[model samples]
Target: MDFDEYVAARGQALERFAYVLTGDAHRAQDLTQTALLKAYRHWRRVTAAEHPDAYVRRIVTRSYVDWRRRGSSREEPVDVVPDLPEEGASADPAERVAARDELRRALVTLSPKQRAVLVLRDYEGYDDAAIAATLDCAEASVRSHASRGLARLRAVLSEPTVPEELR
Candidate 1:
């Protein structure tokens, strides 16, 4: 497919990927825009690749990692969650949102590269080799990141709901 068509088809997904990486809607949009602009310059090369989406996703992932390394995009995580709409007075939706938020919060504790590795491997179901290629790292590094990331996430998520200070 052509560049325009590719963007049309994958734009939202790409933005969502960035959102997962950055945890901020505005930053996600910026990251997606940057990746797409870069891809547009080499549209022919990108589209000619066997998995063009993966190619563009690599752009987004690498940009995110690089941005994190540079300590740019100083967006802070939101401390307050907006009220969710009540679904027929059921609390299930709220619970799910809480879980998702908890996971997002837990994810932020990971280093950017580790977060990228986990998101690509677990969230996106990419294999280690693919993640290595996407992150421009070795497969062993991918495995190390994924292992440490998961461990960190578990530790963060398993903490008591009541803060130790509260306790």
Candidate 2:
């Protein structure tokens, strides 16, 4: 397919992949746009690849890693805290949001490579070989990153949260 067609079919998926990789919607958009621009510059070559989507995804992943390496992605803390759940709100949705927020927090604690490996392996359902190709790393390195990433997440999430009474 041509560049426009490829984007039309895959843009949202690419953006979602980037979001999972970066854990930020705005950064995901920037990463997706950067990758698409690169792909557009060499559309013929990209479309000729065996799996063009994978090619674009590799670009997004690399762009995120490069951006992080340059130290432009550091997050500064905000003085204002988020609103707590409403007193009468149902517990299930609030619990899910809390869990998701905790996961995002845990993800940010990981190194970029570890985050990428975890997202590509677990979130994207890619096998070791595909993750290796996407990250341009050895399969063993991919396995190592995934293991360490998961272990970190477990350590962070499994930490006990003090109850309101305790606090």
Query: Tens digit of lDDT per residue, candidate 2, span 19-127?
Result: 8877677888889999999999999889889999999998998998888888876454222233333455436797668766766676777788998888888888999
TM for candidate 2 is 0.82
Q: Residues 31-137, candidate 1: write the lDDT tens digits.
A: 99999999999998998889999999999999999989987655654343333234553457777777667777666678899999988987789999999999888
Instruction: Show where candidate 2 strays beyond 4 Å.
Output: 74-97, 162-167
User: In model 2, what lDDT does residue 9 have?
Assistant: 98
Candidate 1 at residue 110, lDDT?
80
lDDT of each: 0.83, 0.82
Alpha-carbon TM-score of each model against the true structure: 0.82, 0.82
Q: After superposition, how far is residue 104 of candidate 2 from its true place, in Å?
A: 2.5
Q: Which ten residues in a row have the lowest lDDT in candidate 1?
A: 77-86
